[model samples]
Target chain A: MNYSNFKIPAVAVALGASLGGLVYGYVNEAISLALEAATPYVEQGFEVREDNWSGEVEPGKPLLVKHQLFRGNEYWFWAGTSWPGATIKVDIFDSEGNSVGLESFARDSFAGVRALPQKTATYLIRVVAEYSKTGEGLTDEERGANDPVEGVGEFSGSLDWGLVYGYR
Target chain B: MVMIENVIRIFGRAPLAGLGAVFVATLIFGAGLLNAENAPNAPERIDLSNFPGEMVEKVVVPIPAEIFAVLEKLDEPDWNSGIELPEQGDPVGERAILALTFGSLVGEGFIAVQAKNADEIQTIGKRVLALSEALGLAAAVRPHSLSIIEAAGNSDWKKVRDELDATQQTVRTTMEKLRDDELSGLVSLGGWLRGTNVVTSFISNSFSEDKAELLNQPGLIEHFRGLLDSMKGPSANSPQIRSISTGLARLEAIIAPSTEISEEDINQLRDISRTMLEEYYFEKKAAETGTSIN
Candidate 1:
């Protein structure tokens, strides 16, 4: 079997296809998770916007999104990821880097932050994702086995995350 | 470190083959930590120009209702005074003009909702349908238009507001999907101009600092200017768009200088929006009537 000639192309095709599928699947899952996280807010009379932002994010690197928010409207921003054991932090900041987020929650797969803007201006929504081995419902032994360093655990590479918002 | 030892132990009998892999993984993990360390803290403003993470480029412009909702809380300016129904005219043919009209019509719908003017709302709904048809978006917009009329009839102002927001979103999304980015931008710009005109007029009438502060949206002005600057083809060179570009520049100059818009600034903003809208509508009418708008 002369498999040498086919090796490079085979690897390339497999790599490309897997990478594409992973990204697509993760993005879709992230969006769904974000919407799920927004369910409580929606139930509270917050109208979830149809548009959302999604992309790959390296663990621990913060993603900043500049958005326009009007005063007198209470807003909730939710972010989600499909990465297992992921801890997502979402917050809203003003132009001067002042934290304007009111109530915020972060769990394993999703997080949310609320903001009642003081002015009608451009705001920055910052999201950061980090992996936690213990948060995945792992037992003590499993956590100990998987955990490598003090803060470092299993590296999940870049994660796909989605962000959605609602206003009341 | 323990995991690395475990790996070494697992391959300990195999000439330290796992050492290289562990070292590489450590370096990659270290690099991520270094990047995280380099990132600005939450209280430090990020420099967007050198932003490293993937920035979601989509900027969702707030619909007129959002701003109107804010205005409702500040002071009870007579929203009815802002509701001036533009004369019902022929359907616009040019896509750019139609898009602008559609956006402005939606803005009018918002004002009508604020005023609780059922008849005006119904009229704007019909006009919106006609303009959407002219812009080749009748199918997507018809349901919303119908809903708008129905909601207005029921005096469900909130539903009408939602439908109007949805209608604008649908139109913008459809345009983007069809690669009509320019038309989509014009729609937003039109809505913004009309909304701004109404807000500025209302604030100028009452002259409140808080209400005037709502007009502190230099970023939005810059966004619209960027849209105008990015327009290509004949639409880019059209007198209407160029005039809009000039108007936006004037607005930016007025808005970018101060955090709080003064009464005079409000009046100027209102006049700029009013003049631009009047010129655009007048030019369209003049073209239709075979009369020069000199």
Candidate 2:
């Protein structure tokens, strides 16, 4: 009947369960809203006035978002996920994984990449969210010569992430 | 001393399990911190040249309003000029036609917002509700329709426009989630056609290369071309899709390489878009009357 009898093991179990749910809640809900919110920034900064394409994605497995970017329009692509310590990356690429866009912005929960397609072309937008410790110190320049996925560690399970894009 | 030894033993006995417990606690703690107001990790710009992005096959380009906004910036645009009332016909009978009709109605909704015409917005809003029901998308679409009507009444044209955009997005995402990709494609193509028909008319009359520059949408054309090729069932075999496929390819050739959006090309695109919109509605009406198109 004494409280001290159940101290360490019980506390550790309780902590584990609590944190697991906390991370899942953000992954399932909060981050998705953040991605949608980022859509407006494209509208204001680039004068983009409408929704184009958007889709749901999961972490671990990468998503290839193919969008038809016109020649003259400047476009912003946003991707996000809410897994604490999870990496969200949105990059534009060609068929051979070449850089179609030179810049992508990322934070703990989301990323936005901009591309001004010089000509009408079909480009791939890769959005990936994952639990990784390696990406913390690595800059894009250092990973510049390597495949972006090289540093991504494996985390398995079904999780929710989303990406949306707009153009001016 | 006994408690410390027991704790160590608990960890040592399940070392891998111990690391897992620590990981979970850390993740949960971090999540809690992030959930606190002022999430420090607000998204930032990532322009990593070396980050190779993968591609998804589906592609949806920007909508008409995007170009419209830019045009508004470029000059005082007479949004009312190219705006023509859609000829009212009994909502197309076929489900496929209904999907396209839904897209058309939303596009009309966008125009109504632009013209600030409450009457047209209300009419379109009701029609959108009816069509969504017919398409079995009532649940996904009801709120947007109601918002559209409510916004129309308030004369919050911007709100009306947003609701219309939301309406279309809801329908497309719903369709996509349900794996009704073909219907999703039709919704997008229909809205696009309506917008293009109006824009082409505006640009053709004005004939500015600057305006025509927007029509350099070969990427969208390619997307449509691919969409048509991917169609299945009657929707695939439908004369409507075949013609659209051929039409987009031709348009793609004109605009491909995204260079020199010629006046001739714009005029041709306008003609094609108008004809397609007309043919689609006409066919729907014809199907309803049990009559054949010539």
Candidate 2: clashing pairs of residues: A19-B28, A64-B55, A64-B56, A65-B56, A66-B56, A103-B47, A104-B46, A104-B47, A105-B45, A105-B46
Clashes (backbone N, CA, C under 3 Å), per candidate, total: 0, 10
For candidate 2, the docking band is: incorrect
Model 2 Cα lDDT, one tens digit per residue, B188-217? 888887887777767776777666776766
Candidate 1, TM-score vs. the true structure? 0.74
Provide chain B TM-scores across all predictions: 0.78, 0.75
Question: What would the per-residue lDDT of candidate 1 be over residues A12-119, giving only the tens digit for each residue?
Answer: 333322321111111256756777776655555676765567777778888888898876667888888766566687878888767887556776778887787777
lDDT tens per residue, model 1, B219-271: 88888889889888887888877888898999899897346678888888887
Give interface RMSD, per candidate.
Answer: 13.7, 14.5
